[model samples]
Each structure stands twice: as C-alpha cells, then as structure tokens.
Target: MSALTGKVVALTGGVGGAKLARGLIECLAPDQLLIVANTGDDFNHLGLSISPDLDSVMYALADLNDPQRGWGLAGESWQAMDALQQLGGADWFKLGDRDIATHLQRSVRLREGASLSQVTRELCAALGIQHRLVPMTNDRVSTMITTEQGELAFQEYFVREQCAPAVSAFRFDGIELAQPLPELMDWLAAPDLEAIIVCPSNPFVSVDPILQLRGVRAAIQAATAPVVAVSPIVGGLAVKGPAAKMMKELNMPATATAVAQWYGELLDGLMIDVVDRELVDTIETKTRVLPTLMSDLESKVDLAQAAIDFARQLD
Candidate 1:
C-alpha cells in the first residue's frame, strides 16, 4: 500500500487501544497522527491524579511499556507498593516506583493550573514521544460502573475489585458538562482530515465516555471523515480487560456484531478479526476481515494499516 496521507485521529483507551496507537505512530509521521485518550479512568489515588489510559498510551508510544504485564513501565520496580502494603495502606492498585513519579509530576502540574491536555503533552514530550497525544477532555469526567453491588467508581470496580461485579449499566459522571479538547474539535473541523479510527477499546467504558462528552459524538458525526472501528472482541471474547464480560452482563451478545451495534451509525466501517469472519454477513456497516490481535509489533502495524486502508476505500 502507498503511504497514508492526511491527518488521522485515533481514539483509544488503555492497553488494547495503546497497542494500535503505537502501530499508527509507526505507520505515520508525528504530525500525521493524533491520539485522543480516555480520561474517564482518571482518579485521585493516594492524593495524586492518576490517568491510567493516558499513561498507557504514552508508555506505548515511547516504547517503555511492560509487554508482559500489559501496563506500566518496563523494568518497573514495586518498592513503593511493597512499602505501602507493609504500612497497612491500600495495596490493591499496584503503583510501581517509576509509575508513582509520573503521577506525582502530573499531580503537581495539574494543581499548578495546567490543563490535563497540557500536562499530557508535556509528559509525552518528556518520554520522547513525537506524535500528538491529548486527553478526550480536560474537564473532569468519571466513569461509574453500575453493577449488582451498586454504582462503583471505575478503578474501584476495575482494579480494586478486579472487575468482579456484574455490571448492569455505565454512566459518565461529568460528561454532560465536559467539553471536547479544543485541538480535537479543530481536527474534526479541518478540511484536510482523513479518517477517525476508533481503536479496539472497551465500547462501554473506554470509548463511550469520550463519545458521551458534550458535542464529541455530534462533531464526529458531522465531520467529513469516515469513521472506522477495530473490534476489541476476538472470537467472542475480549483480548483483554472486561469488555466481553460486561457485554454479556448487559444482555448483549459477546460478539463482533454486538460491538458494531454498540457503536451504531457513527461507524462508516468496522474491522473484525479473521476468527470472526463469520460475523461479516450479520454486521450492519461495511466490514473488513483481518487478524485484530496485537500480540506483537508486526500484527499491530498490519491491523492498523488495514483499518486505515479500509477507511480510505470508503472514501
């Protein structure tokens, strides 16, 4: 395939989405790509602002991510978490020594009147990441997972509770009041914009929170760019995280078709794994069958290229 031209914006969540973001970064120049990360998972942990998805994307782009654990810095040490446990502090969420430094720096900057987007840009630069990375919104928006036990904060349900609760629904606490980042809005309005690639992120919590932000969905709908989504589910199961489990609990089928349906009319095309090729006939939008698993760099770049090529074809 020829070189991908024009600016492309990728909407991503934590690990799964970050993998694709890294692929896109490799496929395009720093100026040609922009990553909008989910900040719904952001919370104040141990009195420090923690943006899990942002950190994950940054780590991935900088080649500092721990592939084995699927999160945090590679060669990470857990001296802090170990000490916290010995001091009888909450140790459910493991924060490694290097990881804590990120949080501490971000927390300080945020308290110093820096916007989340500004802080993220600075952090990305510090990590030597060239491609632009922005949070979905600078405004505070928390994802609340409503489950059998009750409504719980995102991290409380995802990490502390280990995603054990059966989720019935989800809500973005401050989404109604949140505004899309100015840079993202400008990109959506740019005449030369090419495509919007929705990374294979959790539809309910990861991608939904960004969509629920005021005017974000409408902007994408109105943009001239064709929106394409990569399925997070492969062969009826989520590659990582609790997406599949959440889907089943919400009475939706744990299938690629269901994932497409959840995104609805916003999608111009949907990319499904080869294992889910059977779902093509049932999927409502235009479909592209490829191996969506990102077990390594090659697969991730190939899938990223496929998704972009499919979107270009739609044009």
Candidate 2:
C-alpha cells in the first residue's frame, strides 16, 4: 500500500471511539492527525472537574485505560471511592485513586487560569501522548439527557440511574454561548484539510454536542473535504452504550441504516459492519461494509485504516 497523505480530523467520544482513535494514532503521524473529543460529558463531581469523554480518549491513547472496564486507568484501585461511600459522600460516580489524581490536577490547573485545552496538553505530555487531542471546546457546554423521569445530567443518567430511564430528548446546555477554539475553526476551512471522520460514538449525546455548536454543522457542510462517519449502530443494536435504546425511544430504527439517515446528506460516506451489509441498499449515501467491532488492537487499527481508505476513495 502507498503512504497515506493529508491531515485528518476525528471527532470521538466514549470507549468505542477511543479504540478507533488509538488505531488512527498508530496509522498516522502525530502531525497528520487531530483528535477532537467530546467534552459535553464534563461535569463537576465532588468539587472535581471531570471530563469523562476526554479522559476516555486520553487514557486509551496513553495506554493507561482499563480495557475491560472501558474507562479509567488499568488496575485502578478504588479505595478512595470505597471510603467516600462509607462516609456518605457522593459515590454515585466512582473515582479510582489514580483517576482522582487526574481530576485533581486538572481542577487545580483550570482554577489557575489554564484553559482546558492547555491543561489537556500538559496531561498528554506527562502521559507521553503525541497525537493532538483537544476538547470540543474550552467553554462549558453540557449534555443534558431528558428522560421520562425528567432532566438529568449525562453522568447522572448514565452512572447513577444506569441508563434505566427512557430518553425523551437531549439538550446541550450553554451550547449557544460556546465557541470552538479558533484553530479548529481554521481546520474546518483549511484548504489542504483532507478528510473528517466522525468516529462511532453515540449520536444523541456524544456526537450531537460537538455538531450542535453554532456554525459547526454549517462549517462541515461548506467544507470541501469528504465527511465520513463510522456507524455506532450494528445490526439492530448499539455496539456499546445506549445509542440503540435512544434511537428506539426517539422513534428511529436501531440499525446502521438509521445511523446513516441520522447523519443525513452531510456524510459523503458511511461505514457499517458486515453484519449490516444487507441493509446497504436501503441507505442513501455512499456506503462501505467492514467489521467495526474493535475486539482488539489489530481490529481497531483495521477499521481505522478502512475508514481512511474509504475517505480517500470518496475524495
């Protein structure tokens, strides 16, 4: 195979997205790739600044993530959380000892006037991560899940309630006031920018917060580069998280076709697992069939490589 060319931007959130992101990191040079992680899941818990999605990608890229749990550091000890629970502290959101250090430092840095991006850069450097990883924005825009029980923050719905409530709608609180870092805006308009890959993350919470920002969708629509997305839905279920459940609750099909339709005409191509290949003809946009389940490092790399090739073909 020939060497890959041009810069690529990947929008990612959660474990599945981070797995593919690690694959892209292996395939592309640090300078050629930029990873934009969703920060909508960020929240203040026990007075610590917690960025769940960003930490997921960061920990995965740094080789510190717990693969089995799909979040937090590997072999993480939870004495802190255990003690907190004993003391009647807020333990709904479990915080491992090492993971708490990360939040502690991040909170201190943010209070010291470093932007979230700057703090993230410092953390990445300490962890020896090279590829560019940035929060969707430094500004606070939170993902609010509206459930049958009423409104709840993302962590509350996901962790506390264990995603038991049926989702009725989602809102990005403070999104109207949020703005992308100037450089990201430039990337959207950069003439030489090659392709944009929307990683296989939850459409409602993970992906929407980034795209719902003012002018982001418009920028994507106006960009010349081909926009491609790897479908989070496979067969009639989500590979991870509540993407499929939310789809059903929102009166949409829990299939790759529905995923493709959700992205609509914005995508130049949509990548689906081979299990859903039979549904390709039902999709409107250009489509590719490949195994998307990242069971291991090699499979993740393969899917990342295929997505890039698909983008190059569309280009």
Candidate 3:
C-alpha cells in the first residue's frame, strides 16, 4: 500500500485499536490523520476523571504504554496505589504513580472548563505527539452494560468485575445529549477525505458508542469516503478484549464474517485474517483476507497499510 492521497480518519478505542492507530501515525503525516477516541470508558474514580481509552491511545502513540500489561505507562511504579490501599481507600482500579499524573491534569483542566478535546490536545503536545486526536464528544456519555447481574457502568463491568457477568446489551447513558465533535462532522462532509477506518476494536462497547452518537452514523452514511473496518474477531476469537464472548452471549457467531455482518452496510470493506479466508465467500461486503493480528510494530504497520489499500479498492 502506497501513501494515501488525502486525510484519513479512524474511530478507535483501547489496546487493539491503539496499536493500529500507532501504525497509522507512522504511515500518515501529522496533518493527514485524525483519530477519534472513545470516551465511553471515561469515569470518575478516586476524585479524578479517568478516560481509559483516550489515555490508552495517548500512551500507545507516545510509546509509553507498558508492553507487558498492554495498558498504562511503561516503567511505572504503583506507590500511590500501595499507599491508597494501606489507607483502605477504594483501589480496585490500580493507578500507577506516573499514570496518575495524566488523570490529575485532565481532571483539573476539565473542572476548570476546558473541553476534553482541548485537554487531549494539550496532553498530546506535552508527550510530543503531532497527530490530531479527538474525543468522540465533549458532552457526557457513559457506556452502561445491561447484564445478567443487572446494569453496571462500563468500567465496572470491564475492569472491576473483569467482564465476569454475561452481557445482555449496552446503553450509552446521556447519548441523547451528546453531540458529535464539530471537526468530525466536517471531516465526514469533506469531499477530499480518503478513508474512514474503524480500528479493530470492541464493537459492542468501543465502536458502537462512537457510531451511536446523535448523527454520526447518518453522517458516515452520507460521507463520500469509503468506510473500512478491520475485524477484531479473527477465527472464532477476539485478538484482544472480550468481544468474542460478548458476541456469543448476544447470540452472534464469534467469527470474522459475523463481525462483518455486525457492521453490515456501514462497511465498504472488511479485513479478516488469512486464517478465516474460507469464510470470505459467506460475507456480503467486499472483504480482504490478510494477517490482522497486530502483535508488534511491524505487524501493526502491515495491517494498517492493508486496511488503507482495501479502502482505496472500495473507492
């Protein structure tokens, strides 16, 4: 895949999505790529605002995320968490000493009236990241999971409970009040826009929240750019996270083709791993068979480039 001619936009969440975003940053110039991060995982914890997916992408792009853990900062110490634990304070969510600084800055800036987009811009600059990063919306939107155990906040179900409870469905609390970021609307309307890539992220909790934002889906439908998605489900399992489990629990097959169906008409192209190539014939959307598991920088870059090529073919 050669260099793409115009601006590219990616809708992303945590971990897997962040890895692909890092790869895209390597391929596109600073002015050419825009990343819209999911804030549905945002929550208030221990008196600080925590935007998990935002920070995940931030850390991943900045080359600071812990490689072993796949979340939080590298070379981190947990003195703050240890102290908080000794004090018997709420510490189910481990906040690293270094990682706490990010939350502290974001929380204070937000409380002082800076929008999340503004704060994210500042944070990205501090880390020397040149690419543009935007939150899905500035207004409040929480991903609430309705489960066999009743309703729970996104982070509660994801982190605290370790996704133990079987999910029934998802509701984006405050979605009606949430508006799409103005830049997003403009990007969708931009005739020169090249592609809109949905990163290999959890569809239920990550990608869905961004799509469900007021008029985002309708705008994407109306956009001239091709919409491409890299299936998070490779084979019958998720590369990361509990997407596969959630799919089966929701009565959908946990396969790449099934993921294509989940996105349906929104996707002009679906990239599934070569392992699932046999199922390509079953999918209605134009599909690309490639190595979609991005374990390191090389593979991540390869997958990102493949996604770009697929998008171009769609056009």
Candidate 4:
C-alpha cells in the first residue's frame, strides 16, 4: 500500500517543487493532492500578469513543462519573443509564444474582476490537470530582495541581474495585508489530512512567503497532520536556483541542517539528501536521509514516495 493515501497538502515554488509535485501526482489520486504555490515571483510584464511559479506547477502537472530548461512548456517556440526583440521591446524575461496564451487568458480574466484563484482554477481545468493547484494568496505580495546595491524586485534580482548582487535580506511586500486562501485554511483544519509536505523550494523567497502569511504558520502548527520538508540544498548546492548563495549571503551555512533550522519547530520531520547524512545529528527535527535529487522522472517519484513515507512514520 502507498504511504500517501489520504489528502496531502503540498507547499511549493517553481521548477524543483513542480518536479516533485509531478511525482506526487503520479503517486496519489487526483483528489488526494492539493498544491499551494508561491506567488512572490509573480510580476507584471508588458501589461500581462505573469505568474511564473504557478505556471511552472501547472505545466508540470499537465506534462507540458520543458525538463531541460526547468521552466516554460516543452517544445515551445519563441517567435513572439523574437518579434518583440525586433521591435526594440525588453526581452530580459523570455515569454514564449505558447506561454503567452496562458498569460493573455489570465490577464483578461483578471481584468474582468476574477480572483487569481478563480482564474487559476479555470486554467487548470483547461490544461486537464486533475489535482488542485492554488496560489498562496490572491493579494499581491512581491518579494523584495535587499542587496548591497539596493532593494530590487524579485524578478529583477533573479532574472535581470542574474542574481549577481550580494544578497542581504528578503522582504515580502504587502504580506501584512495578504490573506491565506480560505480553502487552504479549511484543509489545514480538516480532521483527516494526512500530511503537509513543504517541497524542496527556496526557503527565503519561495516557502517563507507562504509561511509568513497571516494565520498560516499557526494553522500548520495546530494541524493534526505531520509537516515534512525536503531540503532544497544538496551537497552544499541548490538543485536549481540561488538558494545556496542566498544562505551564504545571509551568513548561514549552505547545508541541509541549515534548512531544517530555517523551518524550525513547524516541521515534524525533514528529508535531506544522502550527501548530507553526516549532518543529520545536528538537525533538531526528525530526519530522513535519501536521494533528494530529481534528475529524472523516476528519481522524482522515488524521492516523493520517500518523503511521504517519512511523514507517515512521523505520525
């Protein structure tokens, strides 16, 4: 029998998180999984509201994400980007022709006064994704990266600057007024919730923003389900983004133990990579060392199963 049988709530970001999300979808029934994606990376580009993390998760679930690039649809064409470049338009963030359709539809719906969650649901239905995927909140919560140069928007620091600036700290603007999704709160309060898995995403920008939402941390702490996290850092390096660099810039060691410390008491257990097995004794929470790297589909599935199994054992 699968260890992940009951309803599971997963908090995730883009790329790394989506890869594991795909694995979880493969392992669990459609109704058994609920994904809450980070919206901190969202921004307005060319008058279109682009949600990078949400699109990444949705594409992964729909089997349309490009594995090589770790973002955007597979077999995508960049004709639109090329045309924009020809017109002297800013192309720092490449938006492919296929991806443009998603943004266009979402922008129209949003302009028509639909909530982000509602629009996301419609998009998921169109993409044939069975599992539920939700943004952290409908309200705007931009990730502000404070660096030596100055404060830069999340996308500017990440994409435009190529993360070259020395990171000092991070702040989620508008987070104070941001509300957690009503369904998410209800799920946390549900009596039969099996687990809450924090995917291997960037703690500072991705997962922290979700946890920082009003009443979210308290809800997780009060939940009946065990909360588990898969460390994004493996062998002192991040699987994709600049998580490791951020950790170092913030005067923290880039290790799985540091990640466990970041999540602290909210986590009942943590799944670290085998490469960081030696640091297990230092982790405050219950720890399971496994191959956390998701280089391929099979690896992603195995790691997902291992995390679910670990969370079940915690109960």
Candidate 5:
C-alpha cells in the first residue's frame, strides 16, 4: 500500500478504469478511493435505464466480475435476453440475467424520482461495496455518436455497429445542464487527497466526457494533488476494447505517445505498458514506464503499489 493511508483518488470510465479501480480497492481502505463514473454512457433501453460504466465498476469492486468477459456479473445467465429475443426485441446489446437485477432496481428507484447518484449509492450498499462510487452527474448526459453513417446512440455505435463507423465527432447531449456531483467536488478539494489517477480508459469516449463536464477539467487542474494517467494503448493497440481503433478512425496514431498527446498537459505522469516502454523517452510529455497489464490479483496489487510509489516520487 506504500503507506498511502488517507489518499483520495478519483477514477473514470468502465472496464479499463474498473481494472485499476479494483487494484486500488485491493490496497486501499474503501473510503480512500472515490470513483467518478462517466454518466455520458447512460441510456434508456427497453424502457429501463442502463449505466454500463457504473455497473462494470460496481461489479468489479464487489468481486463479482467475470474475468474472461471483462464486463458484467460473474456466472451471469442470458435468460431475460433470450426471452426478449423471442419477443423480437433488441437483444443485440446482450444484457445478462443477473445484470438485469441492477437495472430493474435502478429503474424502479428512478421512476420514484430518486437521483442517479442516490440509486447508485443504494446499489453499492446492497452489493456490500464500501467505497464511494459516484456518477459524474445525476442529470441526463448521453454520449451522442457522430460517424460517417450518421449520428447514432452510444450502444448502436459500440455494439450493433460493432464500432465499424469512421469517427466524425461526438458530443454529450444535455451536458451543458449537467453539474458535477457535489461529493466529487468536495473530495477533489479534500486535504487528504494524495494523487489523482486517471485509469487507462478510452481517452476520447470514456475519459473525455467526464472532463467535458462544466467545471470538471478545471477542478482537476486546480486540485493540489498530482494527476497521473495509464495508457490504454500498448504496442500500437488497445490492451482491450476499441480504443486503438477509435484513435485510428479519428486520424490519430495508435501509440502511447498518442495517448500522452491526447491527455496533453493534464497528467503529471503517464504510465505505459512494458510493450511501449521503449517509446517512453520519445513521449512528448513527462511520463513513466511500467507493466500496465493486471492479469491477476497479485499483478493488480503490484500495479497499485507502483502507482503510489510513483506519486511519492513526485513529492
């Protein structure tokens, strides 16, 4: 744990982010980490609200995550999805049976006028996840996809479209009206905050939405804690997901250097995988090299310890 006893760390995005979040959870007391999930991915499906990123983080933290799949509940069944398919519904997104329980409860709570943050907290408590898991906002903020084909909903671009669309642009609808969760802001200003770790999530889609929130980027910039990031791309490819594909489609190089450039001046240090270790010296920004992959619990713990050690070096 590197003696980072009272540090407050904020994380963003889904699977990639959640992996590091899980690592931190293993090493830190639950209260020491605050997860600021990207609510821009929030959407309504089959008349029910769904927050993919939030659910992934929650599932990962509760130790109920499916390691092989990288997302959703462990031992999940597709009963509801199969039934929905028989009824001619859009089962293209693949919502698992166990995962549906979360959506069902969240949907009911939301219908009763509870905020997303409130519902999330309740869900975390029920799952026995003691860390603070917060949505970027309780307000509506959907990530709209602008591609060569046309503007599509997030899931359509990601799942149905299989991320084949040539990237044009993206915008968070209703973001102008969105406010950062108060608790997140308070934590950002916490006296005990040691460093802010931007998990190795997709820079444009995953992390950008949270950065675009009204005062979020500014708050992160102004915070006293040093901010660090792990690159999702390794050896010119994404460790997982379509991050590298999106970068190429967006006319950017698929390299650790590109990831550093995307983050620009925001990060105090950048962590790249051993595969890209050679490029560390060529990176445009101040950075560090480490084995970024967390294949097992031991590796996750080592990565978490490396992060804290890196932060201490900055001090």
Candidate 6:
C-alpha cells in the first residue's frame, strides 16, 4: 500500500468543487484522487451535449482554467457565442472559442459512439491530468427544478435565468435508470480508499444530484473511508454560487450548521470556514474550522491539506 499514497476521493459539483479538487491534486498523488463531477446541469443545446460541470472540473485540473471568470478557459474568446448572437440565436449559454473546441471534440466523440467516461478519460490524458475524473453516470440524467416560472433545466434556472426562479422542488430526471460509471464504482470499492471529500459546492444542485444516483449514496455510506464535506455556506452567504439563496428558499438557514444537517449522518467531519467558527459547535457533524474560501492557490492548498490531514487522523 502507498501509505500516504493509497487514498482515493470522489467529488461532485462544478467550479468550487474543482478549486478544492485542484488543491487536493497538489497534495495527494495523482492516482490517489478520483473526481466524480456533477452532470446534473448537462443539457442539449443546439442539438449538442453541453456538460458545464464536467468541463469546468476538467479545465481546472488541466490548468487551463480562467481565474478571472472562475468558469471557462483562460484567455478565451467568445466567437461561437458572438456568431450565435449575430444569427439571432438563443445565446443564453456562452460558449467561448477555446471552450467550444472542447465541446466540439466531446460532441464529435459522442457522435462516434464514445461513452462520456471514455471521452473524459481521453480528454484528461490529452490535458496531462493524471488523476481519475469520472462523470456521475453513463446515462442521461438531468436536474430539473420546479420553480415559480415552471420546470427549468438546471442550466436554464442557473445560467440563463440567473437563478431568479424561486425553486419549489427539484427532480433528477432519469436518475432511476442512470448507471454509476463502472470505473468510479471500482475506485470506490478499492480496499485502500481512505477518504471522500465532498467539495465546498452548492449542495442542493451540485452534490445532491450525485448523491441522488441510485447506488452512490449507499456506496458512500458503506465506504470504509471517512467522508468529509466542506461547507459552501460561510457567514450566511455562499462564496461562489446560489447555495445560500436556494437553502433559504427551501426554508433552511444559510449556515454551515444547516449544511451539515442537510448531509445528515453521511458526513464524518464538516469543514467550515474560520469565519463561521462559532457555528462549529452547533453543527450536527464533527467540525474542522479552516479558511474554506479558495480565493487563491495557497488558500485552496491549505484547505485541501487540512481536509486530508483530518481524514488521515480519522482513519
């Protein structure tokens, strides 16, 4: 066993998740990490399969991430989106030129009969990212939110609608039929698996979708490794996205304590920001107060180190 080496982790969600994931990749050996990105936001746009979460994770790992925007490729140009706008197309989804290359390649591969996993692996290899990155499933499952405006796809509710719709409920369409990616299952079942870090992502839309997969929750609960979650909520606010608002709409407090409660008994430890240290004792799960915000590379690495240390101590 690789001692400090044999660790395996599975993460879901998008940019925020990717930030911590990049940090973890720096801390752990590449083979020791496995990121399971959320596909809930995935949808067909202009008859093309667009997977925002997966691409974000992949780009972040590949070191091609746009830090300023926090979501697409660095130094990107929006030619595709510009062209679509000129054609008077629905340009709600902005696909930059560099990012569009990734989408086009992925679309073409899928069209040629490649599974999402296979394409992801190929992309990872090409990008020189050594760690394993897998999608939640092989089947088409989308998170549809029932909001005041009506049922909106995750991206439509998030990106296009700017999350303006008051979410009444959410359903993962086709989740019942979605099969866990075999490679992910194999990694989860690995004997040396040491920890799972649920990244500081929007729990409702990001992590929840992955957990909703038929066997994923059960597998996580049954894993010999300890499961730790970093709270996206800090000081009654979300650092990146709409988690806080969504939580409030769901009648839950926008706090780390509430985030831990949402996870229920699934978590062995909850990583909260030092800003919310006072709420540590109030959390349902055991807590570790750290600087959870990944404002820069150092902060991200520090949080990742803290999480890995906590998990190792637990083991």
TM-score to true structure, per model: 0.98, 0.98, 0.98, 0.98, 0.97, 0.97
Candidate 2, residues 1-315: lDDT per residue as tens digits?
216668888989879899999999988888888899899999999999999999999999988999998789999999999999899998889899999999999999999999999999999999999989998899999899999999999999999999999999999999999997666777888877778999999988998888988888889889878999999999888888999999999999899898888889889999999999899999999999989999888998899888888888998
| Winner by lDDT between candidate 2 and candidate 1 | 1
- What residue pairs clash in candidate 6, if any at all? none
lDDT of each: 0.93, 0.90, 0.92, 0.93, 0.85, 0.87
Instruction: Give residue 251's lDDT in candidate 5 (0 to 100).
Output: 89
Residues 1-315, model 4: lDDT tens digits: 265658889999999999999899877887788899999999999999999999999999899999998899999999999999999999999998999999999999999999999999999999998889999999999999999999999999999999999999899999999999898898888887889999999999999999999999999999989999999999999999999999999999999999989999999999998889999999999999888888888998998888788878898
lDDT of 6 by residue, 147-211 (tens): 99999988889999999988888999999999978767777778888898999988988999888
Stretches of candidate 4 above 4 Å error?
A: 1-5
> lDDT tens string, model 3, 1-315?
247878889999999999999999988888888999999999999989999999999999999998789899999999999999999999889999999999999999999999999999999999999999899999999999999999999989998999999999999999999998999888888888889999999998999999999899999999989999999998899888999999999999899888888998999998889999999999889988988888899998888888887888889
Which stretches in model 5 have alpha-carbon errors above 4 Å?
Answer: none
What is the lDDT for 27 in model 6?
83
In the range 1-315, model 1's lDDT, one tens digit per residue, is: 327678898999999999999899878888888899999999998998999999999999999999999999999999989989999998988899999999999999999999999999999989999899999999999999999999999999999899999999998998888988989998888787789999999999999998888888999999889999999999989999999999999999999999999999999999999999988999999999988889899988888888778888997
User: Which candidate, 3 or 4, has the higher lDDT?
Assistant: 4
Compare candidates 2 and 5 on TM-score and give the better one: 2
Model 3 residue runs over 4 Å out of place are none
RMSD of each: 1.0, 1.1, 1.0, 1.1, 1.2, 1.5
Q: Report the alpha-carbon TM-score of model 3 versus the true structure.
A: 0.98
The residue pairs found clashing in candidate 1 are none
